[model samples]
Target: MSQLYASLFYQNEVTEIFSDRALVSYMIEAEVALAKAQAQVGVIPESAAIAISNIASTALDQLDFDALAVATGLAGNIAIPFVKQLTAIVKQNDEDAARYVHWGATSQDILDTACILQCRAAMTHVEALIHQCYRTALAQAEQYRSQVMIGRTWLQQGLPITLGHKLARWASAFRRDLARIDAMKARVFTAQLGGAVGSLASLQAQGTAVVQAFAAQLQLSVPSCTWHGERDRIVEVASVLAIVTGSLGKMARDWSLMMQTEIAEVFEPAAKGRGGSSTMPHKRNPVAAASVLAAANRVPVLMSSLYQSMVQEHERSLGGWHAEWLALPEIFQLCAGALERTLEVLQGMQVNAENMQRNLECTQGLIMAEAVMMALAPHLGRLQAHHVVEAACKTAVEKGVHLKEVMTELDQVKAYFSAVQISEIFKPESYLGNIQDQIDAVLQEAKGEAK
Candidate 1:
């Protein structure tokens, strides 16, 4: 059942990148690259490096995944059995060259570097999706730069704000997420190449040289030391992903709330069989938002597990390292799924300008009380203005009349302000102070980043 519905939840592009075949291929690629690096450093024969690459490149299709799974169960790590199978394949071609296949390397070196390769690949897709989402949101903000809507606080009408201002905030979030992702590349993309004890003891005095060569071969940065005991890189990647997912969740929550039948201010783009209910004919649920929220809810928990795994015993971890095998990939998958869904929501979003206008009036000018208070603050003292507006709001609510009507009848308000000024105070557009400036700032910064 999980496999059947996997495509619905996870992206096919990212799924293929982290598939079993891709993982095994990465491990083999690590082995081949290591051999070449060792050869470059004169630690292994050049013929052996060539032979390892040649055999392992073709051996992927021939390797039995079921057999590898069983061997992994017994060996405690996939690299142990994987290396044995790779060596056997190389030995079949050139027996003498097979001896140097994985010389001076440990299973952790292969596994960790392979995982880094997978992360590097997955992040490319993630970054692209983030860019798409960012651009879509920025476009929306520009398109609706002056479209006024009621800003809600604690689920009640608070004040007037433009839809563009709200979307600019989302664009800014994705922009910051992109910055975070770019900043972490140096820390997270470093190569892992330490022998059994992370000292490269097996490689002797030439360990550092071999590590440098290995990293160069894989186009990865060499870490200051082996990360067998240190899990900061892994934790950093997971933490950043969790933060991005959380931002996506906030967008989804807002969108779903706006789609409520009573509110009906905005909606997910409509399509046949997209968000339809099986029994109810009128249902148009926010399915993409729900999926993004599920990912947002689950990613932090998985990120916490990675944090827990940071505690290791001695030179290596007993169960801590093992815990990462499932958690990290699941994190990547869930994050990818969330990013894709968020992009979908942004691209196909439906905005109801008329509904937004109608909803703004539902409060009968109560949402503009602050505007009235501020306008009257100069004539009446600040405290007196607040009290007068407060009383008028109460009168308006009790009598079911517009606050503008109630305020016009107030003796204090009529004493300070003309009828023209009183009418201007109630206009939602007039009360939207500096919202265009704020939106323009966000758009300008985002465009600068693009340049």
Candidate 2:
């Protein structure tokens, strides 16, 4: 039932990557690669390696996930039953090949390598989606480069800022996420080929050679040491993923607030029955924003489990490693879902420049009081100007009149500025200090980073 929203959050590519069939198929690929590597180092027969590789393609559908689940519960891991099923299948083609199946590799070695392959595939899809989202963000920043809106702090209007200022921030976050993913991949996508207790004592003289050959066959990097006990590399990927989802949540949060009926400064692009309430006809909800925000809210708690699972017992752990097996894939799935939804939102977003202008004006010139304060600061002391404007703002709120009008009548304000000068400071457009310069600088910086 929870899968009802799977299509809304994730895509077919994500399903294919983490599917049961793909999982076994990857494990089999690891087995075949290990056999081939052993043969390369003369630990197994070349003919047996060829036989295992030839038979592995048809072995995917034969796996019984139900049996594997029961075995996993009894044995404390899935790799035990999975390797048994793999060996049984390979034995039908050549008994000699079956003898060498998973030779010198422990269950952790095969399982960890398979999980890395899965992550490699998942990251490919996620990176493509992130790149798409980043490009859309870049387009929004450029299109709305001078689109003006009120900047808010603590849910209240503070000053006038360009829409590009906000969108460029989104662009920069996703751009940096790409680098985090790459750095994590370099550390985590390496081979995990240590035998029992990470010593490879079974392989002995051929251990490092088999490890190198396995990495070469899989096109993954060779690790400096086995990571059975050190889980930080994988945790780094999960942490980066959490941060990416958090960034998406922030972007959605700002846009969702702007879509409010009272604000109406921006909106999710509307379509027939999209974001419709069952009872209400006028609702155009920010559905993507809600999904991304939910992912953001949930990922941190799940990531915490991954971090807690880092404290393993010396060579192996009783419950900690199993915790990671549960959490890491879930972290990937949640982040992938958020990335997919955010990409859709950014590509189809609607911006209302007129509504932004109205909202800025709705504040009755109080939003521009900071500009007036600065103007007065040149003549009066900065603190004194702040006091004068603060009093005028309170008076405007009390009388329900514009702050600019109240300020003109104030003696302290009249002591410095003329009518035209007071009006200039009140205009929201006049208060855009360095928004264009900031936008230009960010866009230029994003261009280099995106490349």
Candidate 3:
């Protein structure tokens, strides 16, 4: 089925990788490799392996896709029809070779391994995109390390922080995502080669050898045993992808909020016709963030289906295993789209540092209430200091005067500090406790990850 909004949610390269043709190709590759591996272990004649391999070269052209599609509907899975067509193609060249075509493998073996092949290739691109995002975020973090901005809690200004600190947090997330992908490679990229019902019953004596050789044939790892009933590996891949998509979504939400008209501290990268409102002439939207947010919202829901699908009947799943077919590919496609959109946003994201600094003062010095309270806490009791600052804050708000102006007029404040000290208390930079250190720690960690 074709999606109307596929272009908005999937990158062309990713779509190609998970296309029907690619799945067919991967399945064919699995079949050919299986034949060769069996031959290596003396399970099949070398002539059979060679003939099957030779026919596989042009097997795609020889097979009828239209007929295969119709057959798939009746068979309930593509592997059965695919193997039938492959065996028939091999028979035309050498009848004897066709006998060993799929020798001791089941439909799930080829299908699962083929899907693994597709996922292995797809994740390479995902890992690269994440690295690009990590690099871009780190660069931004370094560039804006000292650029002061307001930190919000409960959607209102709470404290002071540097823009670099914010970007570093983003970079840090991508860095961990990279680690997760790397760690999962060993578990996810393993071959699925149990003959039938997670046992090599058909290939009995040489089962272990064939399993090892089959995995080696495709340059995939050999799992300790078959994963036909063990769906954790597949679920783990979905889980990590959910985390990555969630991170991108979070960044998008933050960026979109920053781009709000009243709080224009950041803007999406500008291009002709990009992020423009269709009806509103003065609107500049966060288009990239919108795409990412869409992916973020959808990927998790898809992941849930995969989690639910983990309950296989016994050795092979009925509907449970089948549930993964569409959901996993769609998850990959969505993540690809989200990652690409994130790259575009991060690489050219516009920072309104002036607006950031200006907005910090919009609260009329009330943002600096903590600094003043802490300064007086040493002279008065903590409660007394808090009570005095709380009253001054209310007066500042009611009179429409700055917190510093009200603080200077308070007798308690006057007795403890000079006018110059009172002025310093309201400076956003003065109260940025350890922001540079925190940003430095994030940068150092990112640099370590790069190595």
- Candidate maximizing TM-score: 1
TM-score of 2: 0.96
Tens digits of per-residue lDDT for model 1 on 195-270? 8989888889899999999999999988988889899999998888889889999999999999999999889888
Q: Estimate each model's TM-score.
A: 0.98, 0.96, 0.97
Better of 1 and 2 by lDDT: 1
Give each prediction's root-mean-square deviation over alpha carbons. 1.0, 1.6, 1.3
Instruction: Give a tens-digit lDDT track for model 2, residues 1-451.
Output: 0579787665677667777778788889999899899999999999999999888878887777889989988988888998898889888878888898888888888888998899899889889989998888888989997888999999988899888888887887888999888877778788899999988999888888999999999999999888898888778878988999898889889989998999988888788868889999888898888888988998899898989988998986778888877777777787888888888778888888889989888979989888999999988999998998999999999999999899999888898889998888787778788877877876787777748
Distance (Å) between predicted and true CA of 72, model 2?
2.8
For model 2, what is the alpha-carbon lDDT of residue 79? 89
For each candidate, what is the lDDT?
0.90, 0.86, 0.90
Q: Top lDDT: which candidate number?
A: 3
Against the true structure, candidate 1 reaches a TM-score of 0.98
Clashes of each: 0, 0, 0
Candidate 2 — number of clashing residue pairs?
0
Off by over 4 Å in 1: none
Best-to-worst order by lDDT is 3, 1, 2
